[model samples]
Target: MSEQTFFATAPAGVELLLAAELVELGAATAQAARGGILFRGPLELGYRACLWSRTASRVLLPLAEFPAADAEALYAGIHDLPWENHLAPDGTLSIEFNGSGPGIDHSHYGAQRVKDAIVDRFRARCGERPSIDSRQPDLRIHAHWRNGQVTVSLDLSGDSLHRRGYREATVTAPLKETLAAALLLKAGWPAIAAAGGPLIDPLCGSGTLIIEAAWMAGDHAPGLLRSHWGFSGWLGHVPALWNRLLAEADERCAVGQSRIPPLFASDHDSKAVRATLINTGRAGVADRVRVERREWATVKPPPGPPGLLIANPPYGERMGETDDVSALYIQLGERLKSHFGGWRAALFTGAPELGKRMGLRAHKTNVFYNGPLECRLLQFRVEPEFFVDRDAADRHARAAALNRAISDGADGFINRLRKNLRHLGRWAEREGVSCYRIYDADLPEYAVAIDRYEQWLHVQEYAPPSSIDPARAQQRLEQVIAVLPAVLELPPDQVVLKVRQRQKGASQYQKQAEQGRFHEVHEGPARLLVNFTDYLDTGLFLDHRLTRQLLREQATGRRFLNLFGYTGTATVHAALGGATSTTTVDLSATYLDWARRNLELNGIHGSQHQLIRADCRQWLTRTLDRYDLIFLDPPTFSNSRQLTESFDIQRDQVELLRQTLRLLAPGGVLIFSTNHRKFRLEVAALADIHLEDWSRRTLPPDFARDPKIHRCWRITQS
Candidate 1:
């Protein structure tokens, strides 16, 4: 009957949108405030907002304001309210207190004080106090304290307006209904739908965006799907007026359903497709929304004019997923350019930088918050002008500029690299080596390890010390990378760059990339698979080239065992060297798979070559099989979860050596090696065993500069 002050709470970035929405919903006056909107409207208008304001989380009607300088003041301020007028003495209630002030530093304490004052007031007045009901309350009171002032209000939208009651099933990280609506509104979906444009969500998780879009386009009230509201049990709720509004909404929805546009939803995951189908049925948009299970790469537009294509693709927030995610964005851009010309596209992502990888220029950008994560909606017009070929043109430009910079200076580094290449290149060709180290930190100013894997170069920048300026280090690295392509006569993409740091345990085995690009390289008579991008170390260890050769030469008729057998390079050598059988042990399933591939590549498989996935230390104690030849190269330090106890080369070498020697038959040879630079053989501890230093013999000629790269010992039972 009369206009009252009302507050509608929304997400931080959605306040302006919510303000505009409330004004359109017949509010007398609406101003966007921090975190919410303040408006003046009649009771009927509030009911309309509750039904139609898709961006607002809740609507609160203020009843009183008072100063609460302390706890007693807070109690007195709340107790002074006319609680009986809002709720019956025997009814249930809940208080949601927010903000911190002089006396209320915690929300729970403030809520407790407010609840105590109300129940105490009721008890003193009628001797029957209302009980607390958190889930469903007759009266939901909200109190805000700031600057020692409290504003109390009655919450008329319960359980967050985003819960439209249609999402009975959901997938991981489903977008909230309010946020989805905000994204659609920001993308101008309403204007597009008004012109009879179709909508498609190729990576729909649970169909939140499609359902929200359908409701917006069809003039369907979001609250109509909801069964209950905060005012449903409130004493002041006018049943007749609310029923009149419900009838009006029903009639509008019935007529609007026919005006809905064709909406399509799909996902690569079958579970996600099923979830979308279930949610669409529950949202009553099943007939209007065509849902399917399809991969993003295969999804095509419906046979009609271009429209809006929006998606919330996987952000790849976890480790080891960046490369795949980047590739996905690149592929998505290619698809858009090749097929969806003239279509409007919007991609909402937590990683805004990834949006650039899409290879399309975003003409417009809008910021939104998905809970605590700040996200961006990148808007693009899929046209020829917006297409960006980052890999071809941009990469060439960068390389050309880098080459120009290098030509101006950097003679010292270039001369040294050429000298090493001329000398080592000849040695590699002479020895029939396809993979070998060409340079190892040759110049202190340019600290990097450059290895030639056929025509490709794998350059590892040794992580500079903390004292070195990082900017200077990066400049040196860029200069080195720039000059490598020209000096080596290889394409820029053929050169892979990575930072090499001190690795402790299984971290060295952790995936650095997911490119899944593996190249075949030859060593002696064996062919092995080496992945330059996916790992810290190429599957084949170049430093072990000479060692694997010696094993092959000595394995004509003996059984060979390879421990800590990463990728089983040494096992491949033994198998090809005519060993009777080969067994390779490691802790990584991924590495084991790689080993299987390597063995298969060399035409060595079946019972003769065994690949076991187990901690080398644990596996050593379990195996009773003896071998005539064994190679053990454990990490310097490993605390992998698969191990019962952490292994340190210095601390556990004695026991590890003993276990391996026990598996060694009489007169058998066991070669032990470690890259721990400071490692020393504890001779006195192994008094009964015979040990000889093979480090000098095992060290390859290319690694002569760094003899400590690895230390090998020939061990035998006394």
Candidate 2:
């Protein structure tokens, strides 16, 4: 095969790495450019790149480069290429037109001109032209034009190299195969594997990184599992030479398979673990990769020399807090230092600042891109000296001092917390409640709410006023965190910290974390699931203890309807109250699922119980069914895009109650509630209904400190 110049395209920030890979693949000279690497090498080298170069998006063999100053010039340049030598007139073709210059300002028009030129040339000679197939074409052509210079190339790697044909299943946010390979390479996995060291990814989601690492370690070509390649249909492909390369790769794979080292992967999610198994099996590395469903904190190195620890941990996109995620990183770093000494670890995170919260200095940091999100690959060697307690490390003396710095009002805050916890604890125990708030801005200086769910402490720091110094607020917060463990006799890990900003409308309903760890807690006579780290509020509303209790008392022998149900904690109370039939409505699928789980937990089921995921306002307006008892606890200011119209308690409550009242059975009662501190009822507007303010009556002892926690009202037909 003759020498040819080839280009391997990679994602931005990876061009230099891809160029290095090409140079290692026998390229005479490899030059890194913006989107790809340009190299002069044997034709087989391009084929090998498609087979083994992991960071490349596509391997292109440029057929021609010319000046295409205009649409007609582009047509002539594309027409002048010997299309007959690469693609048959009867074969289908696809063009990937990129860049623009001079008259070729749009990709679509440039592509159209190129297409017309190819077919027109073919039609003039062969009497027929190849058709275009964009999805899966018989031939794939790449056109790149910049500053009036156009380069037409044959795409030897049809689909992106990221599609390794192994990910038949995936969990949310699974890393692309090429990016995963890049992560592993940047982490020095090749060197580690060469030394027969083990590898582990604690937060392995869908096994992309683990499987890619296994393949790289076992000398298996990534394309070996792929059945299709751009060159498979290209007329320029040399069948004999391709087969020889495949045979060599196969033999090397067999040899490397025998010497494969220990590889392990785990995820907290069972679904992800199952997916990892399925994907690894499909990738032909199931036997070599051991997968388990386990939490990241509990993961220990396998019984072997320490190798590498890497993870694509959740970035709190679905649900998480800076404090929660920061604590997680700290835990990860601590575990690595204590348990996996001498091992190397790489963490790929979009928030590099969070990585700093791990408390371990990074030996090296490499910038990479996960699509549009700029990410960093932080490398750490888990040396004992590096793992020493931050307080003991002299360089961190300031942080330690900050922790010790008790702000002027911190003592008062701690005192208020202790008093509240004692009072709430006694009340909760007497009431058989396992979850309730202990503090809610009891001291003005420490603007936070503290809740206890069994053994876990969920702390929500209220966004302090801008009038306060941020440094002072953070210092006070650190003091509270430092004091909590000792005051509550809980481990630091059990203390889940979150910052609570005043959220409007549906933003409060959005998840803060996707940990999926649920704790079963007792609320009145109901068994409910509450997540401390995964959401803004626990599944159960502690302040509504009395409200739900009131629901239980009134729901007996009556039909109950829960609007804006919110995990159905109130519905659960009503169900256990012997309601003949119950219907729960909410807009969130996640909450509805949680509601079902709440019902299932308490042995509530059958046709008498219904869970409808719909906008409560819309459901109320359309439902012909009437109920004897109703709970209308709407958000303070809801503006969900999923709803037909936005809802504001102050502005829309009249219409909301008007629609809800129509669904109320005659002689039945409706319990309306809101957390809007300044909410005012339009008594004159709802003159048709008899209303009584029950806000004080439903206030729980634990929430007496904050009398304005929630306002409640009882409405009945006149």
Candidate 3:
């Protein structure tokens, strides 16, 4: 067979890696291009790439190139290709069209045109047309249209090379096999493995990293486990050559396995560990790879010379809050420094800023893409000289700098804060409200909310808008911080600072810090726990002070239920109000435990004052219990892993209300509240329920400045 031009596609920032891999697999010349690599190779080289190249997403064999300025031109160019040489009249086909151009703005329309052209050509010449079989096509065609130029090719690797056919069980957000290989190659794992060094993944999710490492160390072709390929049904496929390569790969794998060094993997999640074990077995590396369920803090290095220690830790994308994720990275860095000394470490994170919290300085950093999220691979030489305590250093530097005299520009902020303290302070003391907002962006220049919890202050800076210069924002924030110690008559250590931004999904419920610090605060005959430095909110919602008081005022001898209970402050109030029974339903185990503590703190306990950990929506549907009073305050949006589908307050409000009402006994009252500012009550939909807008009536004096802080409704069956 003659030489052919092939394009090997890869993820963004991996073109050079893919190019090197193609060259190693026998390409005569490989040049890196955007999103892929261009190579010139014989037909056998393309086949070899399909079977050996670990980084390439797909290997395409170009058949023709032409001008495709319009749909008709595209169809004509596709029709002119010798379809008879590729697919028979009765064979199945699929088209993957990319890079839209003039009159081809949509990929689907362009692909339809290509498919039509091919089918029309086959019908005109052979009296029958190939059928479209997207899942498993006999012939998969790829068409690229750019700048009125078209290049059509045969996709020799179907279903993406990343799908190596070994991952039968998987946890959420497992790393792609090809991307994992790129990470290993970038870390020079092959060299380490060849030198008889061991590799360990402490947070291995489904074992993609370790499996890929084992494959590279064992000289096993990535495609050896794959049972099918795009070239299987291609008319030009040389089965004899492919068989010879497969046999050679098998022999090499056998020899490579004998010399494979110690490989180990583990995860704190048992499901993930089980998945890694199952996947390793399926990949034929079960004996070579040791899998275990171990926490990052407890992970020990295998007994061998220090090799590569890599991990893809959580980075607040799908799970964990910023502070908690930062702590995880900090813990990982500490573990690496203490236990894995003299090892090569690579940590991949979507939020590159979090990598700074790891303390150990990276000698090298590489950019890679995990799907659409841009991520960084920070490579470190785990030696004592490379370690730096960044968190402690930052705190010391900040404390030293901020301890100086307050800035003159902060006078306006200081005056306003003092005035708020004078007014809200007196009201808080009179009403026995210990946790209340002292200043809520009272001055536009500050853009922060200062809440007083007993003697400690929690200052949350609202994320500044894009229009404001970041440096300017930082300066204003520092001025506020500098002035707070003087104006509040409290030491700087009493203040905890956090940046508050709009949260999506279930991030608001995640733990910001694992400080496990809780302080008791009083409000109208109830004592609740609040943490100044551990969470976005201090477990207690100050705006709902009046709402909880109302629940307490009306809860005499009534059975109560709290939905989306969050810390169960309302339940605690109701239980103290002498309710006959109380049950709190929330999805978070952490919050549920906190609720249990709140109940015990108030000396309210028993199965009757129950704390249930479950998705409230699903629980509401399944429970047969009834209640005389219900408090329902759900997050604006929740896409928790526990939920089959996400909940939108605006979209699902009516349905949620109806479900809660089902549990409400006759003449029972339901208090539905949400912090969603723009929430509109769908009164017409709830015609059967007697609903009253209690938003104004429930607002406490402390929260009056922000009328839209929350919305409340008193609901009952008509």
Among all candidates shown, the one with the greatest TM-score: 1
Taking all chains together, the TM-score of candidate 2 against the true structure is 0.70
Task: List residue ranges in candidate 1 displaced over 4 A.
Answer: 317-323, 396-558, 565-580, 586-622, 637-648, 651-655, 665-669, 682-705, 714-718
RMSD of candidate 2 to the true fold? 7.2
State the lDDT at 628 in candidate 1: 93
lDDT at 531, model 1: 84
User: Model 2: how far is 426 from its true place, Å?
Assistant: 15
Give lDDT for model 3: 0.87
At residue 444, what lDDT does model 3 achieve? 87
Per-candidate TM equals 0.82, 0.70, 0.72
Give per-residue CA lDDT, model 3, range 640-677, as digits (tens). Answer: 88899999999999999999999999989999999998
The Cα RMSD in angstroms, rounded to one decimal, for candidate 3 relative to the true structure is 9.3
How many clashes (backbone N, Cα, C below 3 Å) per candidate? Answer: 0, 5, 0
